[model samples]
Target: MTKDEFIQELEVLIRARYGVILINTLEEERALDLLTDLARKLNKRLLTWSCTRGLVMDGNTAVHPDTVDLMTAIAKAEQLAEEPSLFVWLDLQSHLNSSPVYIRRFKELAQEIRERMPSNSIIVGPLMEIPTELQKEVTIIDMPYPDLNELKMIISQFAQQYRDRNDLQIDCSESALDALGRASIGLSKTEIENCLAKSLVQHKRITGEDIDFILEEKKQNIRKSGILEYVDTEKLETADIGGLDNLKKWLEIRKKAYTPEAEQFGIGWPKGVLLVGVPGCGKSLSAKCVAASWKMPLLRLDLGRVFGMYVGSSEANIRLALSMSEAVSPSILWIDEIEKALSGLASSNQSDGGTTSRVFGTILTWMQEKKSPVFVFATANNIGSLPPELLRKGRFDEIFFVDLPNEQERAEIFRIHIKRIGRNPENFDIAKMVKLSGEASLGDGVRLTGSEIEACVNQALLEAFFVRNSEGHPEGDVTSADIERAIVQSVPLSRVRKEDIGYMRTWATDNAVRASLAPESALSSAPESPAMAEVTVGRNIDF
Candidate 1:
């Protein structure tokens, strides 16, 4: 929900005299600011307390300066003046769960406030660590990160703060402000302020150019999370991804799925897609390319890292990861090789005290019920290990099986790798590699994965690099004989894991959509002759 809607809900609960309200958030300062506003609306004085600083009126002098102990602060709160007030307790969760005496005292204090006057107590912390003893008496609210409107307000305030400074200029046109607002959606008030300050210091002004600074700040924040890894996505364009035409086509159609116009047209946000197939058939690469294709940040989630040794810690980590993903909506959450990460599903009850089972259930439930625009791009190689619940309809928009590249796709994969190394693909004899595919049985199958095709081109380049020319330099040309040799020496996973590939292929026939547009008939088609037998590579080398 939006921040304004959340504030309205909190106001209702406060007016209804909810004895104690527990808010979970990392933005302590922002929460306090919100409480001060709510206090004004309720016509009550705002009082705040911390472990170090006893009780102090909001923006006013301390009420109990000598009371440094937490118990003493609670006693003073219990004896509040007859006037209604809102008591905001900061960082009291650690003791609330550890000390029984403190718990009983806080419960009694809550009862006193509810029975005596319109005053209420609020506990704000980084997590919702409420003890079971007071769960019935306290209302828990999971505060969300700053939304677009809140971010715009933060940007406007920063601009106004520097309006008097003659050295700095703030060009906040409606369009510029909107761009900054959208870019700063996931940042907290303090982060937004700090980012804007840094931008002004570096550029002497705030404009559309400052969005990169905000994104860098987000990367730093995500790194601290530990569960989510930020990817350097500048090099991951859709053009770099080879083959998977059907998958690429599917993604292109939904490029504008998250825009305001789509929503206005009654189109809901696209849920996500699942890629299941053999290893290294462009599944994970496709996951990364989506972020670039969609112009969004990419976050990698490692489920193995989420499982903590302590009780309930694993669940907390998942909550943190998922919450942070939602905070940065219009982003991609890539779960690579998900089957291995979510393994031990059947024996979770017998082994890890059902922790894995609970964690698995939590992820599936979130995938099914999440309303945010964070797209879940999950790739799994071992379909047998995956839970049946994840395979059910609606969990993912569609399940795609990325099989081994067909005849034409293998040639395209070869061309992509050659071009990536700064050599023209037309110089290499790719048709010779395709012809070699028809000559070898390669165990039970001739299909090669995209990775194996890349290896063939790389090996051929190595061969060319070692061959010397008459000028005593390495020969510049990669020949058909070099490619043929590399293709014959390379081994495809389809040869070693024949049964596994066969089962997955059989399953894909009925349960999943194919990732490549090549028809099954195209697999047996003959190769075309190359326009040139070989192109020289030595001249293109910078050395």
Candidate 2:
């Protein structure tokens, strides 16, 4: 939802006679504009109160300018001098911890508004919490981040207003404006404006080149909190993902889910996915792929850093991190190795007085209840250490088991690594190396994972670096034999922990969706088995 939609929703709440409302937002000017429009629509007066400015009536003038105290402002409103008015309180949440009587007074004011008055009290702040005393009396909602169209308008207006500036140039083409708008997706109104200003001041032009500058701005904001890292996925794309076609097909459908047309069609936002699989598979890479494929900002959330030494500080840090994430919505939040962060949940109370448990609970609650378009891409080595509450149906949209790369996926991985090293796969017999790495060429059913395949490619290059041609000159080109030797000498995770892999595979057979697609040979005919059916959900998106 955008600013206009928020105003319409607020109008409904006011018309229904809701007494007290709490809006958690940092856009004070935007909120004031929304409230002003709401008041005009409802035919009510707009009274804004601040800690320093006291209480002001519909206009800027105040009858009693000394009504700066929160209690004094509430007392004046209780007298109902303005029968139908919106009493907006600013910086009120900061004092909720200083005194308890203030909570009681707010509760009574809510009751009085419902029973004896026609006005409503609005408490606005960057961060807010219900005092538990007025939990039922207060209705809380978040002001959503600006959508694409709103951002486009912000850019258009700025460009027109500053077109005559001699120092800075602007690109007002429709395509360029649309690109700028999409680039500013997760930023606030102020941040978007700041990005354009910075681009002009630093580069002398607001063009496509400012994308990097704008992203740098986002990274600076994320770094201030020290929990989430804004990832740069410029080099990563869906094609870089070797396999997980099952997961790929699922993700491809939701690539455009955040568009306005999708919302108009009543399409629900995708919650998230849990990837539990082999250590060397593409679980982590898939997170980067999804963010790149969706054209959304990627944030790496380090859950371990959320803990603090002070009491309740850990919980507060997690909340702060999540709040920042929501502020940058229509983005992807990647939590790699989630099991390590949540491994202590079972014994959290005995160890640290439930700090981990509380932190975990806060995350789960937000994952389930968040209305923003933050798609969580969490990867775990195994699910044994994860709390059962996290595995419940509502926590994630789907749980995918990313197994070792199959023959086709292994071949793709090899080709990708070879090209990275400036070598041609065709020169190295990738097909033969792919067969040698899998069970096709080996009697034992051994297979290299995506990471192991890349490793084999690197080791082959290392071996080839020392070999000399007939004239004693170095033959730096890798051969198929070098890769085969590396494959034979390597001990993969599948072979090292055979029993553990068996257990995980069995669990996934029943509980999780298979990530890799069936081999091309198997799909030539019909799916003969149920496992193949699950692995090949639908045709992969080739385009």
Candidate 3:
């Protein structure tokens, strides 16, 4: 929640004489500043306690220099018979949970405040450890990260600080400033301020270029969280990915759904898609592409690390991971090979005593009820292992079944990989390599996946780097013959796993959407194998 909204609610609760208020936050100074203003507006005495400071009134007047322990502080607070007062207890979570005597004293203090007293007890610390008996008496407030409006305020205040300095120049468009605020979403307010200040000291200028510096700050912040991984920035546009033309169209429309115009048109975010099909068909690559194309932070949720060694730790880890994802909104959470994470669901009750089931349930509920703009980009190769509940309606926007690339897509893939290495595609016979990649050209019945096709170009580069001419120098440039040798020697996974691909095609026919458009001419001339599977996609075009 915004600071204004939080202060408003706190004021209302204080006037109504609530007993105990628990604030779960890391921003102690920010919370205290708001509370100080609230106490002034209500004309109530504000008291604060710490182990070293004992009991202090309104800033620093000591109630008792001897009252420093937890029990003594409670007793001292109880003695202060002031009407309409507030006691903010700092650094108490670690001390109170140990002793039953301390717990009983807190319960009595809460009761005294509710029954006859006119004051309230406020506990500010990490995720609350309130005693089970005091659950109903305490109310929790989890402070939310700053929103875009608050971020803009911070940016304005930052720019104001350097208004007198002629050396500092600020250049930012309205849209770029908005983007900068969104990029700085998950960082603490202090981190954001420090980043903006550091940019001025380094370059004496603020522009759209400051975004990279802010993003670098975010990388450090995410690393400290220890739950979500901040994926390295590898930017890829739609043009970089080859063949998934139908998927590309769908993504292009989804990108527009996040704009302000779409909000005005009453359109919510399009739920993310689940890419399930053949291995190495660019499913994981699509996740990275979306993060780069949309300019959103990419976080990978590794399931292996989430399942902790302790009994209840796995469930807690999943919740923490999901919470962190929401904190970084308008971001992509890439869960690669998701089915493997849930593969033990059926036997969860028997093996780990429902730990796996509980973890899976947490994710299922989060996806359905989450209001955050965290797009879950999940990919999998084993569709059979996935539970039917995950494939149900409204769980994901859609499930696209990726298949092996056709002849034309192979040519496109070859062109992309070759050009990426600074080699001219025109200099090589790409048509021959495309034909050789499929079963139509060779009797081996192998259709290389996107990764396998890239491997062919890499293999050619390695061979050319080693071959020496008569002058004892490296050949330095790859040839069409070099790539041809790599293709002839490599065996694609499609050839070895024919039955698995056929089974996946059968499953897709009943339950999933097609990722690529299949041309009828190509399907007709294909051999009697998984390559000839008759797939019918949406009628964006007629065959």
Clash counts for all predictions: 0, 0, 0
List the lowest-lDDT window of 10 residues for candidate 3. 534-543
Question: What's the lDDT for all of these models?
Answer: 0.80, 0.80, 0.82
| TM-score list, all predictions | 0.93, 0.77, 0.92
Task: Report the C-alpha lDDT of model 2 over 1-543, residue by residue, as the tens digit.
Answer: 666777777788887778888887888877787788788978888988888888888759784876888788788878863489888988887766679977877778888887778888888776565677878888877787677788888888888877788877878888888888877776777888888888877888877667877677778889987999988787888888887878898888877687889999999888999999888888888898788878788889999899999987898889888877877777888989999999888899999999999999999999999988889899988768878888889989888888767667877888888888997888878777876776555434346788988898888887777665544756356778888899888877676776676667777876788787776775566323333333343223343
Better of 1 and 3 by TM-score: 1
The deviation in Å at residue 333 for candidate 1 is: 1.1
Better of 1 and 3 by lDDT: 3
Task: Report the Cα lDDT for candidate 1.
Answer: 0.80
Ranking by TM-score: 1, 3, 2
Specify the poorest-scoring 10-residue window by lDDT in model 2. Answer: 532-541
- What is the C-alpha lDDT profile of model 3 across 423-450, one tens digit per residue? 8999999988987888765544458999
Model 1 lowest lDDT segment of ten: 532-541
415-440 per-residue lDDT for model 1 (tens digits)? 88878777887877777676565324
Q: Which scores higher on TM-score, 1 or 2?
A: 1
